[model samples]
Target: MKMDLGDQGLAGNAAAGGRPLAIEARGLIKRFDHFTAVDGVDLAVPEGAIYGILGPNGAGKTTTLRMLLGIIDPDAGLRRILGAERPHDVAHAIGYLPEERGLYPAMKAYEAIAFVGALRGLPLAEGRKRGKALLEEHGLGYAIDRQIRQLSKGMAQQVQILGTLVHEPRLVIFDEPFSGLDALNQGKLEKMIRGLAEKGTTVIFSTHVIAHAERLCDEVAIIAGGRVPFAGPVDLARDRIRPQVRLETRAEDGAWRTALPADARREGRFWNFTLPESGIEPLLRALIEGEAGILSLSIERAGLHDAFVAIAGEAAARALEEGETEERA
Candidate 1:
């Protein structure tokens, strides 16, 4: 979807939900031995916004998420989660779903959820009650008593997701949450994320998939080579590239062709080019006056995928494609 190109603000002001930041990180760095995984990363996520950390596999997305969650201390830099400088201090208020999905095969669906909640300080009984309600609400009530191994892959994944929310956390961080789901399940997950944001829960998710971020995120950070190249509102990223113009005319050659920019490319009867800085009015006037016989004319704002390619460079974009291919395989 194309958003109107507006102010070039990062996640602040209205973009930050007019509330305090739920997460703030500055110059976060993580290293493994001599290998640097995340370098000089920074992020500002609002209290009730859905923010996405976008990058390909091996781009330090997971490492960055781990740093934010306090699962692993950053070798350098600082971070604050849910207004606490120490993420552990706010552990009970946060929910995390790691990229690696796991659930004891022998545990029943509701039991598994309660176990996870217990780890986060939610009482087992309360968790079970919430778990059953969540399952029924999400159309999984029939699977409530079934063991994890007995459920389908999609069902198991859903169970784990429910477990993540069983404690009703104020902040949720999901690393590559859509990694292995089918189309239907992916849609469900997207809806769930939106629901959380609607209820004033802050959500931060890392993913290589651009479509999800484009559709759901209010602000995003485009990371490449273990660093962020751009971080701001989705519309700002899209505005990095000018809107494209698609024009179909009956005339093969005329003064209208002269008015078209030199960068315009002709494909049969269609002429395509970047919308001129002077806008489409001048171009339309020229076409009409020159009798170009316009059959169709439309302006298309760049999508998030195109904006990502423009901001992250072709190499990083290619890496993202390769990651998607591997996921499919």
Candidate 2:
């Protein structure tokens, strides 16, 4: 559900009352000299929601996050985290994992996690205690004493994820958090992201990899050339892109589905076509006669991959504008 930004706090994220907004941004804009990296952006996330930010490279996502973290200031806009001014005042309530993750290579894994917790204002003793528990929970307890360098790449990635949550913040933002992991580790992290949101902590993460965001975020904002092309529930995002649907007639061998239209693109024994919202009635009739060889048929909605391509294509055009301007200059 969309959250109202009338109040902002962990509780403000709730759909109503002083409920938490998890995270909310309004009129968010940032620029570099003559260029705008992020145009006007607005986002609303309720408590216990997993929201994703999707955009092509140079879409101003990083800049937006940086401004929220107070690492940089936006030229215009407002950001609220757990109901407070972000970064400077709201730092304690937010956990952040940047796209470029790093840890002290020589530090012990446990120590690094604790150190992160401490930075978030947790006491050393408590941080260490919780840090160990987090590591163990993520299947990293054995690596507590190991140097960060000693851990494999995925292990180190897990440590970073653990550290991001050590302070128990009400909101967490992870950028490209799944970039380098293998399938197993990716699944593990996906579960963890869901678990975090389930516990009333709003989660927002960014990725160029649309599938990860598609499966994770309850709502997403796709930006291009610093502007929002689509924002809202993932379903809405897919709808906004409005790509073709694929109907796979799972038939085998030489015999084709007599009912299927001749226009479908064939893959192996299957033919694919988009089922229009109005109805697939006309097409269904065509498929009936061809139904003899039809083993099965399924309608698959346009996935996030298609959404990204559709949305990003517009962004690419806007970014290309800059090149044209520069050449003219």
Which prediction has the highest lDDT against the true structure?
Answer: 1
Off by over 4 Å in 1: 1-19
The window of 10 residues in a row where model 2 has the poorest summed lDDT is 1-10
TM-score of 2: 0.77
Q: What lDDT does each candidate get?
A: 0.90, 0.74
TM-score of candidate 1 on Cα atoms, chains taken together: 0.92
- Name the regions of candidate 2 deviating beyond 4 angstroms: 1-20, 241-272, 281-297, 314-329
TM-score of every prediction relative to native: 0.92, 0.77
Candidate 2 clash figure, as a count: 19
RMSD of each: 5.9, 7.2
RMSD of 2: 7.2
Model 1, 137-246: lDDT tens digits are 99999999999999998799899999999999999999999988998889999999999999999999999989999999999999998999898899999999999999
Instruction: Write the residue-wise lDDT of candidate 2 on 150-231 in tens digits.
Output: 9988789889889889999988988778767777888998999898888888888876666678788888887777888777
**Worst ten in a row by lDDT for model 1:** 1-10
